[model samples]
Target: MILHTFTLTLGSTRPIYGSAHELRGFFATKFTEYTELHQHNADKFIYRYPVVQYKMIENVPTVIGINEGAEVLKQIFNDYQEIRLGENTYQIVERGISLKDEEFGISDKIHSYVFMTPWLALNQENYRKFYTLKGKPERDEFMRKILTGNILSMAKSLNYDVPGQIKCDTNVRFQKDRLKDVSVMVFSGKFHTNFLIPDLLGIGKSVSRGFGAVQQLKANNEGGSTCSSSSTQGAPT
Candidate 1:
Protein backbone atom coordinates (compact mmCIF):
# COMPACT_ATOMS: atom_id res chain seq x y z
CA MET A 1 0.00 0.00 0.00
CA ILE A 2 1.08 3.56 -0.69
CA LEU A 3 0.12 6.70 1.27
CA HIS A 4 -0.05 9.99 -0.55
CA THR A 5 -0.12 13.17 1.54
CA PHE A 6 -1.07 16.57 0.18
CA THR A 7 -0.08 19.59 2.28
CA LEU A 8 -1.96 22.78 1.56
CA THR A 9 -1.83 26.21 3.17
CA LEU A 10 -5.40 27.43 3.37
CA GLY A 11 -6.03 31.09 2.67
CA SER A 12 -7.38 31.44 6.20
CA THR A 13 -7.16 29.15 9.22
CA ARG A 14 -10.76 29.47 10.33
CA PRO A 15 -11.05 25.80 11.35
CA ILE A 16 -13.01 24.16 8.58
CA TYR A 17 -15.57 21.61 9.77
CA GLY A 18 -17.10 18.80 7.70
CA SER A 19 -13.82 18.63 5.85
CA ALA A 20 -14.35 15.04 4.80
CA HIS A 21 -17.40 16.04 2.78
CA GLU A 22 -15.49 18.82 1.07
CA LEU A 23 -12.54 16.59 0.25
CA ARG A 24 -14.82 13.88 -1.12
CA GLY A 25 -16.64 16.32 -3.38
CA PHE A 26 -13.38 17.83 -4.64
CA PHE A 27 -12.03 14.46 -5.77
CA ALA A 28 -15.32 13.16 -7.16
CA THR A 29 -15.71 16.24 -9.35
CA LYS A 30 -12.11 16.21 -10.54
CA PHE A 31 -11.74 12.46 -11.16
CA THR A 32 -15.10 10.84 -11.95
CA GLU A 33 -18.77 11.67 -11.58
CA TYR A 34 -20.05 8.25 -10.60
CA THR A 35 -20.81 7.83 -6.89
CA GLU A 36 -20.33 4.07 -7.03
CA LEU A 37 -16.92 2.53 -7.64
CA HIS A 38 -17.08 1.68 -11.32
CA GLN A 39 -15.93 2.80 -14.71
CA HIS A 40 -18.42 2.96 -17.56
CA ASN A 41 -17.30 1.22 -20.71
CA ALA A 42 -18.93 1.15 -24.13
CA ASP A 43 -21.10 -1.80 -23.09
CA LYS A 44 -19.90 -2.91 -19.68
CA PHE A 45 -19.20 -1.51 -16.20
CA ILE A 46 -16.01 -2.56 -14.46
CA TYR A 47 -15.88 -2.62 -10.67
CA ARG A 48 -13.08 -2.92 -8.15
CA TYR A 49 -12.16 -1.86 -4.60
CA PRO A 50 -11.55 1.84 -4.63
CA VAL A 51 -8.12 2.18 -3.01
CA VAL A 52 -8.30 5.92 -2.52
CA GLN A 53 -9.09 7.23 1.02
CA TYR A 54 -8.66 10.81 2.13
CA LYS A 55 -9.27 13.12 5.14
CA MET A 56 -8.31 16.61 6.14
CA ILE A 57 -6.03 16.96 9.18
CA GLU A 58 -4.92 20.39 10.29
CA ASN A 59 -6.11 21.75 6.94
CA VAL A 60 -4.04 19.33 4.86
CA PRO A 61 -5.68 16.82 2.53
CA THR A 62 -3.88 13.57 3.24
CA VAL A 63 -4.63 10.65 0.92
CA ILE A 64 -4.53 7.63 3.24
CA GLY A 65 -3.47 4.98 0.73
CA ILE A 66 -2.86 5.26 -2.99
CA ASN A 67 -3.65 2.88 -5.83
CA GLU A 68 -5.14 2.89 -9.34
CA GLY A 69 -8.01 5.04 -8.06
CA ALA A 70 -5.79 7.61 -6.41
CA GLU A 71 -3.26 8.00 -9.23
CA VAL A 72 -5.72 9.98 -11.36
CA LEU A 73 -6.45 12.62 -8.71
CA LYS A 74 -2.84 12.74 -7.67
CA GLN A 75 -1.63 13.53 -11.16
CA ILE A 76 -4.22 16.19 -11.84
CA PHE A 77 -3.84 17.91 -8.46
CA ASN A 78 -0.08 17.90 -8.61
CA ASP A 79 -0.07 19.19 -12.15
CA TYR A 80 -2.83 21.72 -11.93
CA GLN A 81 -1.38 22.83 -8.56
CA GLU A 82 -4.50 24.53 -7.17
CA ILE A 83 -7.69 23.46 -5.37
CA ARG A 84 -11.00 25.11 -4.52
CA LEU A 85 -12.17 23.92 -1.10
CA GLY A 86 -15.50 25.54 -0.33
CA GLU A 87 -15.24 29.31 -0.64
CA ASN A 88 -11.49 29.29 -0.17
CA THR A 89 -9.00 28.35 -2.86
CA TYR A 90 -5.96 26.56 -1.46
CA GLN A 91 -2.53 26.76 -3.04
CA ILE A 92 -0.66 23.50 -2.90
CA VAL A 93 2.42 24.16 -0.84
CA GLU A 94 3.87 20.66 -1.17
CA ARG A 95 2.84 17.14 -2.13
CA GLY A 96 4.41 13.73 -1.58
CA ILE A 97 3.44 10.08 -1.63
CA SER A 98 5.18 7.40 0.40
CA LEU A 99 5.12 3.62 0.10
CA LYS A 100 3.55 1.93 3.15
CA ASP A 101 5.32 -1.01 4.73
CA GLU A 102 3.10 -4.01 5.47
CA GLU A 103 4.50 -4.88 8.90
CA PHE A 104 1.98 -2.64 10.73
CA GLY A 105 4.74 -1.79 13.23
CA ILE A 106 4.20 -4.86 15.38
CA SER A 107 6.62 -7.62 16.24
CA ASP A 108 5.87 -11.14 17.53
CA LYS A 109 5.26 -9.61 20.95
CA ILE A 110 1.93 -8.13 22.10
CA HIS A 111 1.20 -4.49 21.24
CA SER A 112 -1.41 -1.75 21.58
CA TYR A 113 -3.27 0.18 18.89
CA VAL A 114 -4.96 3.57 18.68
CA PHE A 115 -7.38 5.38 16.38
CA MET A 116 -5.67 8.19 14.51
CA THR A 117 -9.03 9.13 13.04
CA PRO A 118 -12.33 8.48 14.76
CA TRP A 119 -13.50 4.86 14.14
CA LEU A 120 -17.20 4.83 13.29
CA ALA A 121 -18.55 1.82 15.13
CA LEU A 122 -22.20 2.20 14.29
CA ASN A 123 -24.21 3.23 11.25
CA GLN A 124 -27.83 4.36 11.40
CA GLU A 125 -29.16 0.90 12.18
CA ASN A 126 -26.85 0.13 15.11
CA TYR A 127 -26.79 3.58 16.64
CA ARG A 128 -29.48 2.55 19.10
CA LYS A 129 -27.43 -0.40 20.33
CA PHE A 130 -25.14 1.89 22.28
CA TYR A 131 -27.72 4.52 22.99
CA THR A 132 -29.98 2.15 24.94
CA LEU A 133 -27.28 1.27 27.42
CA LYS A 134 -28.32 2.85 30.72
CA GLY A 135 -25.07 2.97 32.69
CA LYS A 136 -21.31 2.74 32.39
CA PRO A 137 -21.24 -1.02 32.92
CA GLU A 138 -23.86 -1.66 30.27
CA ARG A 139 -22.25 0.74 27.86
CA ASP A 140 -18.82 -0.78 28.43
CA GLU A 141 -20.12 -4.30 27.85
CA PHE A 142 -21.81 -3.21 24.64
CA MET A 143 -18.63 -1.49 23.54
CA ARG A 144 -16.60 -4.69 23.87
CA LYS A 145 -19.04 -6.52 21.63
CA ILE A 146 -18.93 -3.77 19.01
CA LEU A 147 -15.14 -3.57 19.08
CA THR A 148 -14.72 -7.33 18.87
CA GLY A 149 -17.20 -7.55 16.02
CA ASN A 150 -15.44 -4.71 14.23
CA ILE A 151 -12.07 -6.42 14.59
CA LEU A 152 -13.44 -9.70 13.30
CA SER A 153 -15.08 -8.01 10.36
CA MET A 154 -11.86 -6.24 9.47
CA ALA A 155 -9.91 -9.49 9.69
CA LYS A 156 -12.43 -11.28 7.51
CA SER A 157 -12.28 -8.47 4.97
CA LEU A 158 -8.54 -9.23 4.64
CA ASN A 159 -9.07 -13.04 4.76
CA TYR A 160 -7.24 -13.41 8.07
CA ASP A 161 -8.30 -15.73 10.87
CA VAL A 162 -10.24 -14.16 13.72
CA PRO A 163 -8.14 -13.73 16.80
CA GLY A 164 -9.00 -16.01 19.67
CA GLN A 165 -9.10 -13.03 22.03
CA ILE A 166 -9.18 -9.30 21.34
CA LYS A 167 -8.66 -6.68 24.03
CA CYS A 168 -9.19 -2.95 23.63
CA ASP A 169 -9.64 0.27 25.55
CA THR A 170 -13.26 1.43 25.45
CA ASN A 171 -12.61 4.91 24.10
CA VAL A 172 -15.66 6.14 22.17
CA ARG A 173 -16.15 9.53 20.55
CA PHE A 174 -18.99 11.07 18.56
CA GLN A 175 -18.53 13.36 15.59
CA LYS A 176 -20.03 14.21 12.19
CA ASP A 177 -23.28 12.41 12.93
CA ARG A 178 -21.35 9.21 13.55
CA LEU A 179 -20.59 7.11 16.65
CA LYS A 180 -16.85 6.58 16.76
CA ASP A 181 -14.41 4.76 19.03
CA VAL A 182 -10.69 5.17 19.51
CA SER A 183 -9.60 2.00 21.25
CA VAL A 184 -6.72 -0.44 21.22
CA MET A 185 -6.95 -4.03 20.01
CA VAL A 186 -4.51 -6.56 21.46
CA PHE A 187 -4.60 -9.74 19.40
CA SER A 188 -3.73 -12.91 21.30
CA GLY A 189 -2.80 -14.76 18.15
CA LYS A 190 0.07 -13.92 15.87
CA PHE A 191 -0.47 -10.49 14.38
CA HIS A 192 -1.28 -10.46 10.71
CA THR A 193 1.70 -9.44 8.55
CA ASN A 194 -0.29 -6.89 6.59
CA PHE A 195 -1.13 -4.99 9.80
CA LEU A 196 2.50 -4.23 10.46
CA ILE A 197 2.06 -1.19 8.27
CA PRO A 198 -0.03 1.63 9.77
CA ASP A 199 -2.44 1.94 6.88
CA LEU A 200 -5.37 4.26 7.69
CA LEU A 201 -8.01 1.75 6.59
CA GLY A 202 -11.47 2.67 7.96
CA ILE A 203 -12.84 -0.23 9.98
CA GLY A 204 -16.60 -0.09 10.66
CA LYS A 205 -18.70 1.83 8.12
CA SER A 206 -18.48 4.69 5.66
CA VAL A 207 -14.75 4.03 5.29
CA SER A 208 -14.85 5.31 1.75
CA ARG A 209 -15.53 8.72 3.32
CA GLY A 210 -12.78 8.35 5.95
CA PHE A 211 -14.75 7.19 9.01
CA GLY A 212 -13.44 4.31 11.16
CA ALA A 213 -9.83 5.23 10.48
CA VAL A 214 -7.36 3.40 12.78
CA GLN A 215 -3.60 3.10 13.18
CA GLN A 216 -1.06 1.27 15.35
CA LEU A 217 0.13 3.03 18.46
CA LYS A 218 3.68 2.82 19.69
CA ALA A 219 4.06 -0.18 21.97
CA ASN A 220 4.52 0.36 25.68
CA ASN A 221 5.08 -1.81 28.74
CA GLU A 222 3.07 0.44 31.02
CA GLY A 223 -0.52 -0.29 29.97
CA GLY A 224 -2.45 -3.39 30.98
CA SER A 225 -3.18 -6.12 28.41
CA THR A 226 -6.92 -5.45 28.76
CA CYS A 227 -8.44 -2.92 26.38
CA SER A 228 -8.99 0.43 28.13
CA SER A 229 -12.13 2.16 26.86
CA SER A 230 -14.16 5.43 26.90
CA SER A 231 -17.32 6.75 25.19
CA THR A 232 -18.90 10.17 24.60
CA GLN A 233 -22.27 11.04 23.00
CA GLY A 234 -22.47 14.39 21.26
CA ALA A 235 -25.54 16.49 20.64
CA PRO A 236 -27.48 15.51 17.53
CA THR A 237 -25.77 16.88 14.45
Candidate 2:
Protein backbone atom coordinates (compact mmCIF):
# COMPACT_ATOMS: atom_id res chain seq x y z
CA MET A 1 0.00 0.00 0.00
CA ILE A 2 0.99 3.58 -0.46
CA LEU A 3 0.72 6.13 2.34
CA HIS A 4 0.42 9.74 1.38
CA THR A 5 2.06 12.00 3.92
CA PHE A 6 2.62 15.71 4.24
CA THR A 7 4.90 17.26 6.86
CA LEU A 8 4.98 20.93 7.80
CA THR A 9 7.77 22.35 9.95
CA LEU A 10 7.67 25.80 11.48
CA GLY A 11 10.75 27.74 12.51
CA SER A 12 10.51 30.65 14.90
CA THR A 13 12.86 33.42 16.01
CA ARG A 14 12.97 31.92 19.48
CA PRO A 15 12.63 28.36 20.67
CA ILE A 16 9.10 27.03 20.64
CA TYR A 17 8.00 26.04 24.14
CA GLY A 18 4.66 24.53 23.26
CA SER A 19 3.92 20.83 23.23
CA ALA A 20 2.09 19.12 20.36
CA HIS A 21 -1.16 19.53 22.21
CA GLU A 22 -0.75 23.29 22.19
CA LEU A 23 0.30 23.29 18.55
CA ARG A 24 -2.82 21.31 17.71
CA GLY A 25 -5.06 23.68 19.60
CA PHE A 26 -3.66 26.67 17.75
CA PHE A 27 -4.50 25.20 14.35
CA ALA A 28 -7.79 23.62 15.35
CA THR A 29 -8.95 26.95 16.68
CA LYS A 30 -7.89 28.70 13.53
CA PHE A 31 -9.52 26.15 11.27
CA THR A 32 -12.62 25.23 13.18
CA GLU A 33 -14.18 23.69 10.08
CA TYR A 34 -11.51 21.00 9.80
CA THR A 35 -12.19 18.21 12.26
CA GLU A 36 -9.06 16.29 11.27
CA LEU A 37 -6.83 18.84 12.92
CA HIS A 38 -8.42 18.39 16.35
CA GLN A 39 -10.13 14.97 16.11
CA HIS A 40 -13.20 16.36 17.80
CA ASN A 41 -16.74 16.70 16.56
CA ALA A 42 -18.56 19.06 18.86
CA ASP A 43 -18.61 17.53 22.38
CA LYS A 44 -17.46 13.99 21.53
CA PHE A 45 -14.00 12.84 20.54
CA ILE A 46 -13.56 11.09 17.22
CA TYR A 47 -12.55 7.49 17.88
CA ARG A 48 -10.85 6.70 14.58
CA TYR A 49 -7.09 6.79 14.25
CA PRO A 50 -6.00 10.32 13.59
CA VAL A 51 -4.93 11.27 10.08
CA VAL A 52 -3.45 14.57 11.20
CA GLN A 53 -0.87 14.53 13.98
CA TYR A 54 0.94 17.41 15.69
CA LYS A 55 4.38 17.04 17.19
CA MET A 56 7.59 18.76 18.18
CA ILE A 57 10.45 17.48 16.07
CA GLU A 58 13.87 18.62 17.20
CA ASN A 59 12.20 21.22 19.43
CA VAL A 60 10.39 22.83 16.47
CA PRO A 61 6.68 22.56 16.01
CA THR A 62 5.81 20.08 13.26
CA VAL A 63 2.63 18.71 11.82
CA ILE A 64 2.20 15.43 9.93
CA GLY A 65 -0.74 14.85 7.65
CA ILE A 66 -1.64 11.47 6.25
CA ASN A 67 -3.85 10.59 3.27
CA GLU A 68 -6.94 12.76 3.40
CA GLY A 69 -5.36 14.88 6.08
CA ALA A 70 -2.56 15.64 3.65
CA GLU A 71 -5.09 17.24 1.37
CA VAL A 72 -6.39 19.35 4.24
CA LEU A 73 -2.91 20.51 5.16
CA LYS A 74 -2.16 21.47 1.58
CA GLN A 75 -5.16 23.74 1.64
CA ILE A 76 -3.88 25.74 4.62
CA PHE A 77 -0.12 25.50 4.34
CA ASN A 78 0.28 29.26 4.43
CA ASP A 79 -2.72 30.30 6.48
CA TYR A 80 -0.86 31.08 9.70
CA GLN A 81 1.98 33.50 10.33
CA GLU A 82 2.25 33.06 14.10
CA ILE A 83 1.32 30.56 16.81
CA ARG A 84 0.44 31.12 20.43
CA LEU A 85 1.20 28.51 23.07
CA GLY A 86 0.05 29.23 26.57
CA GLU A 87 1.36 32.74 27.26
CA ASN A 88 4.16 32.51 24.69
CA THR A 89 3.72 33.84 21.18
CA TYR A 90 6.07 32.75 18.43
CA GLN A 91 6.44 34.53 15.12
CA ILE A 92 7.00 32.13 12.31
CA VAL A 93 10.17 33.02 10.43
CA GLU A 94 10.54 29.94 8.29
CA ARG A 95 8.06 27.36 7.08
CA GLY A 96 8.89 24.08 5.36
CA ILE A 97 6.39 21.66 3.93
CA SER A 98 6.91 18.42 2.02
CA LEU A 99 4.55 15.89 0.53
CA LYS A 100 5.52 12.32 -0.23
CA ASP A 101 4.12 8.92 -1.16
CA GLU A 102 5.62 6.30 1.15
CA GLU A 103 5.53 2.56 1.17
CA PHE A 104 3.29 1.07 3.83
CA GLY A 105 2.43 -2.43 5.01
CA ILE A 106 4.43 -5.57 5.88
CA SER A 107 7.86 -6.15 4.52
CA ASP A 108 10.07 -9.23 4.38
CA LYS A 109 12.89 -7.70 6.39
CA ILE A 110 12.57 -6.25 9.84
CA HIS A 111 13.00 -2.52 10.30
CA SER A 112 14.15 -0.67 13.39
CA TYR A 113 12.22 2.28 14.78
CA VAL A 114 12.61 4.49 17.81
CA PHE A 115 9.87 6.40 19.51
CA MET A 116 10.55 10.08 18.89
CA THR A 117 8.01 10.89 21.58
CA PRO A 118 6.78 8.80 24.47
CA TRP A 119 4.63 5.81 23.50
CA LEU A 120 1.40 5.65 25.48
CA ALA A 121 1.24 1.88 25.37
CA LEU A 122 -1.03 1.30 28.30
CA ASN A 123 -4.36 2.51 29.61
CA GLN A 124 -5.52 2.35 33.21
CA GLU A 125 -6.57 -1.29 33.02
CA ASN A 126 -3.47 -2.42 31.16
CA TYR A 127 -1.25 -0.30 33.37
CA ARG A 128 -2.31 -2.36 36.34
CA LYS A 129 -1.82 -5.58 34.41
CA PHE A 130 1.66 -4.57 33.31
CA TYR A 131 2.84 -4.00 36.88
CA THR A 132 1.45 -7.33 37.97
CA LEU A 133 3.64 -9.17 35.50
CA LYS A 134 6.07 -11.55 37.18
CA GLY A 135 9.35 -10.51 35.62
CA LYS A 136 11.11 -8.46 32.98
CA PRO A 137 10.66 -11.18 30.39
CA GLU A 138 6.94 -11.28 30.93
CA ARG A 139 6.66 -7.53 30.80
CA ASP A 140 8.64 -7.35 27.59
CA GLU A 141 6.48 -10.04 26.06
CA PHE A 142 3.37 -8.15 27.00
CA MET A 143 4.73 -4.97 25.47
CA ARG A 144 5.57 -6.77 22.25
CA LYS A 145 1.96 -7.80 21.95
CA ILE A 146 0.77 -4.29 22.61
CA LEU A 147 3.07 -2.93 19.93
CA THR A 148 1.81 -5.48 17.42
CA GLY A 149 -1.76 -4.62 18.20
CA ASN A 150 -0.99 -0.95 17.72
CA ILE A 151 0.25 -1.62 14.20
CA LEU A 152 -2.80 -3.67 13.40
CA SER A 153 -5.05 -0.89 14.56
CA MET A 154 -3.28 1.59 12.33
CA ALA A 155 -3.66 -0.73 9.35
CA LYS A 156 -7.32 -1.21 10.07
CA SER A 157 -7.84 2.52 10.30
CA LEU A 158 -6.29 2.97 6.89
CA ASN A 159 -8.22 0.04 5.43
CA TYR A 160 -5.05 -1.81 4.60
CA ASP A 161 -5.35 -5.55 4.63
CA VAL A 162 -2.76 -7.41 6.66
CA PRO A 163 -1.68 -10.42 4.70
CA GLY A 164 0.10 -12.09 7.59
CA GLN A 165 0.52 -12.01 11.32
CA ILE A 166 2.32 -8.90 12.54
CA LYS A 167 5.52 -9.56 14.49
CA CYS A 168 7.15 -7.10 16.90
CA ASP A 169 10.04 -6.99 19.34
CA THR A 170 10.60 -4.11 21.68
CA ASN A 171 13.44 -2.80 23.83
CA VAL A 172 11.87 0.03 25.77
CA ARG A 173 12.14 1.74 29.10
CA PHE A 174 8.97 2.66 30.94
CA GLN A 175 8.50 6.01 32.61
CA LYS A 176 5.81 8.20 34.10
CA ASP A 177 4.49 11.08 32.04
CA ARG A 178 1.81 13.68 32.48
CA LEU A 179 -0.79 13.85 29.72
CA LYS A 180 -3.45 16.55 29.99
CA ASP A 181 -2.27 17.05 33.59
CA VAL A 182 -2.91 13.43 34.49
CA SER A 183 0.02 11.19 35.38
CA VAL A 184 0.35 8.23 33.05
CA MET A 185 2.83 5.53 32.16
CA VAL A 186 4.68 5.82 28.84
CA PHE A 187 7.52 4.10 27.02
CA SER A 188 10.66 5.23 25.26
CA GLY A 189 13.19 3.39 23.13
CA LYS A 190 13.09 1.25 20.02
CA PHE A 191 11.47 -1.76 18.41
CA HIS A 192 11.92 -4.10 15.45
CA THR A 193 8.98 -4.93 13.26
CA ASN A 194 8.18 -6.16 9.76
CA PHE A 195 5.66 -3.38 9.24
CA LEU A 196 6.78 -0.38 7.23
CA ILE A 197 5.63 2.69 9.13
CA PRO A 198 6.21 6.13 7.72
CA ASP A 199 8.39 8.59 9.57
CA LEU A 200 6.70 11.06 11.93
CA LEU A 201 3.55 8.97 11.95
CA GLY A 202 2.12 8.33 15.39
CA ILE A 203 0.73 5.16 16.94
CA GLY A 204 -0.92 4.28 20.24
CA LYS A 205 -3.23 6.60 22.17
CA SER A 206 -3.50 10.40 21.95
CA VAL A 207 -1.37 10.37 18.82
CA SER A 208 -3.10 13.48 17.60
CA ARG A 209 -1.31 15.21 20.48
CA GLY A 210 2.05 13.79 19.45
CA PHE A 211 2.50 10.83 21.78
CA GLY A 212 3.86 7.63 20.17
CA ALA A 213 5.51 9.37 17.25
CA VAL A 214 8.17 7.09 15.72
CA GLN A 215 10.91 7.35 13.12
CA GLN A 216 12.76 4.60 11.35
CA LEU A 217 16.46 4.25 12.16
CA LYS A 218 18.77 3.77 9.24
CA ALA A 219 21.02 0.76 9.69
CA ASN A 220 24.78 1.10 9.59
CA ASN A 221 27.50 -1.44 8.78
CA GLU A 222 28.37 -1.88 12.47
CA GLY A 223 24.99 -3.63 13.01
CA GLY A 224 23.72 -0.56 14.83
CA SER A 225 21.38 2.10 13.52
CA THR A 226 21.43 5.88 13.50
CA CYS A 227 18.29 7.91 13.99
CA SER A 228 17.74 11.13 12.10
CA SER A 229 18.99 14.07 14.11
CA SER A 230 16.14 16.19 12.73
CA SER A 231 13.56 13.97 14.36
CA THR A 232 12.39 14.23 17.95
CA GLN A 233 14.64 13.50 20.93
CA GLY A 234 11.85 12.59 23.30
CA ALA A 235 9.32 14.98 24.82
CA PRO A 236 10.36 17.37 27.56
CA THR A 237 9.90 16.17 31.12
lDDT of 2 by residue, 1-237 (tens): 999999999998998888899999999999999998888899888888899999987788999999999999999979888999878999999999898999999887778899999999886777888999999888887787777777877877889988875656788999999999999999999998878899988878889999999999998112122222222212211
Question: Which number leads on lDDT?
Answer: 2
Candidate 1 lands at a TM-score of 0.63
True-structure RMSD, every candidate: 8.2, 6.2
lDDT against the true structure, per candidate, is 0.47, 0.84
TM-scores, all models, native as reference: 0.63, 0.91
Model 2 lDDT vs. the true structure? 0.84
lDDT of 1 at 59: 54
